[model samples]
Target: MTRFAQAVAESTRSVPVPRRPDTGRTRVTWRQRLGRDRVLVLVALPGIASLVLFHYLPLLGNVIAFKDYVPYIGILESEWVGLANFAVIVNGDPLFLNALGNTVIITLLQVLVVFPAPIALALLLNSLMSERIKRVVQSVLYLPHFLSWVIVVAIFQYMLGDAGLLNNFMRDYDLGTVSIIGNPEAFKALVTGQVLWKDAGWATILFLAALARIDNTLYEASAVDGAGRARQLWHVTLPGLRSLIILLLILRLGDSLSVGFEQIVLQRETYGADAAEVLDTYVYYNGILAGEWGSSAAVGMVKGLVGLLLVLGANKLAHRFGERGIYQS
Candidate 1:
């Protein structure tokens, strides 16, 4: 009986236990482990859905660029024109070059001038000892960001238009009125100033957050080493914020073509499209107004492709500089 029991035990040991059936709940277990991150996914769902619906889903409509798109006939019934629309937008449209040129120039100016101002402001605010004064300054600066483009344009018009505040002052003083807003030559500066006024404060928030994350110990150590305030800022503060600065710079570069649409559109008529028309306004005028949907869509598709390329290129460049771009390596 002992030998028989031993044999049975050995057989049982040799035999594998019947594998438990998978309940297909491995993904659920992983999601549960994520905990708070699951909430982020839930929160992100709406935005993801919106982008999928409005941005990416509309990619299907790029087919319209290859066809003679007509509202009555619809995209499905439209006659396929292949490269005709692309050719027209590329060669036939004179305004395309003008708008593209203006957009590039304006975008470059904003990147060089306006983008750095926020970082400088953030550094300045971070250096200040008085929190109350910093808060007050921040509040005043941030006010313009909330104002609509219409209101912003109106404010500019009120201050710089032909018979407006500046002109009125010029007349009173018997001095020549400066053409700041409406003049074609001054349009770039005007747009840059407007962007600085409206968005510079808001842009500082990220930089300030970066500044806050900097190690206080570094500053203290720098002081111990007999470093002055400026030296501390140069050695400790700027170096600490380098990663954030590069990341933001890459993002701005990725969006180089998208300087301002609404602001430019609002004043396009006043300045003549020559001064104010950008890629966005070009789409509106050429696509919507002229009913050249195919050509306009082609231009838009080109811009989208270019923007994607720019983002990828900028990300690569940022990584080359030993900084994480939009995504970490």
Candidate 2:
């Protein structure tokens, strides 16, 4: 044997081996922990099963976008139409173009104006001195978020509809009454306003959370350095929330095509299709009402694909600016 092997053998012969302690207790503890985890998974099984059955399973229906889908014929019997549906949406459908334009306009308007309002509101609330006043303001703000869209729309109607509150008050005072709801020219503005009223407070929750997580020491340091409130907000608060702001912005970009689906559908008749027909509304009208399933599915598929690309692009852009996007690097 080699010198190292001889040394190891001599060491082994001189040393007494110690007996291993019983591991049955440790094994039983591990078994108990595993049993608890299994029970937790069992409790979550219904939700997991529902998502698989309803959400993921229904994804198979998207195949209809590529076929001449007929309800009575079923998916297997339907003739393959290849790219015909997509071609019609791109080259032949005037209404599709109109709806696309409206969706883009609304998305842009909301992203620029409405999206920032919650962040601003949250910052203002975070700066408040009195806890009671802050709590009251938050409660009032969050109340609107829980209101149904139908109720919100009805409230808008009561305030802005012809011979409604504002118009009647204007007439009684001999002031000019403005058409706000049914006016095609103001439809974008009205939708943005509705969004602001309904969800601005709710959206503030995320920003407020982000603001709360910021280091108070940074603010104190800024104050010692002779920075004013505005300066601290701009330099310290905003910088701290930058990653969260970018993440939220990327999510909004992914959902750009989905702007104002139910809202547009509800008001389409009032403003006419030309003014209120967003992609989702267009899909509903054409697919469900007109029985053009393939065409509508094609539109939806396109929107989903484009949205996916936008999110990917935005995430990449965020990383280029030295920030982690929704996903980590």
Candidate 3:
């Protein structure tokens, strides 16, 4: 602040501003409010109905975790088995444990690598002087996001498969080819890479929006104070993005357990269960394929509970750091 501005602020600190007289604001009734917002309500009815139908209504099926839920017997007719279904988790079944381990490993890898990819890309994009170039690059980067998981997996298989581009090129040059697709050790990394390739560009949208919202004057002020580009980014850009970063981190933690059902399952047979199995596939194989409905329900319920705990824990951590994470305290 300038000297005059500082003096003005200091003077205002001692001045007690007169309070406005209380004019009671008339309270609007629920019906009146509803009438005023009827158009908005109408517009929102489909989304509300969809949420109730798909998200909330399916919650009732968690009861299957406490029952010997046979599809033929139907949900209502299923025998009460109480905690029997959860024994798979409590007793630590070998397959379940393996799936859980794989899940943790993939989630951690994503947190380390996949999560920061968009932020880095956004920064790089923001540094570009040409708007045309930025738009073209962004379009190319996110084009893959619109492609289905099937297409993505197929593209990777074609490029990284045993007889694919890498091996073909290596053969022409007499260089040894490294196995990537269907390799047990590389499956986790492969999954993370695929996620980064597909979603990173799409994710950059929010960060770019956040960057646009930052005050241009802050950058000007930092420059006036002799701050270089890197210093301005560190001091001005990152601080502006901190809250959004925290909010995204909290959300990502909540859904961390689900690596990719369709993506992983497509390659699971080739990689084998030990290499590629995740919680989603575990539930699918046991429930739909093997008809262990109750056990699958138990596992799924546990997944959701764990996710809830992660969100709550991360939100609290954000609060401690004084950032509004996902919600207000």
Candidate 3: Cα lDDT at 177: 94
Task: Name the regions of candidate 3 deviating beyond 4 angstroms.
Answer: 1-24
Encode model 2's per-residue lDDT on 1-329: one tens digit a residue: 99999999999989855544775333346676778799788888999999999999988899999999999989889999988889757695799999999999999999989899999999889989999999999999999899888888889989999878999999999998999978999888999999998899989999999998999999999999999999998999999989999999999999999996777777889999888989999899899889888999999998999999999999999999999999976
Q: Per-residue error at 49 for model 1, in Å?
A: 2.4
Point out where model 1 deviates above 4 Å.
1-42, 89-92
In order, the Cα lDDT scores of the candidates are 0.87, 0.90, 0.94
Candidate 3, TM-score vs. the true structure? Answer: 0.92
Compute each candidate's TM-score over C-alphas.
0.87, 0.88, 0.92
Q: How accurate is candidate 1 locally (lDDT)?
A: 0.87
Task: Give the per-residue lDDT of model 3 (tens digit) for 187-255.
Answer: 999999999999999999999999999999999999999999999999999999999999999998889
Q: Model 2: how large is the Cα RMSD against the reference?
A: 6.4
**lDDT ranking from best candidate downward:** 3, 2, 1
Stronger candidate by TM-score (1 vs 2): 2
Residue-wise C-alpha lDDT for candidate 1, range 1-329, written one tens digit per residue: 69999999999999856543685333345555678488888899999999999998999999999999998989999999998989855585678988889999998899889988998999888878999999999999899999999999899999999889999999999998888777988888899999999999998998898888888898889899999988997898888888888878777766777777888888887789888889999988999999999998999888888888887888888888787788865
* TM-score: model 1 vs. ground truth: 0.87
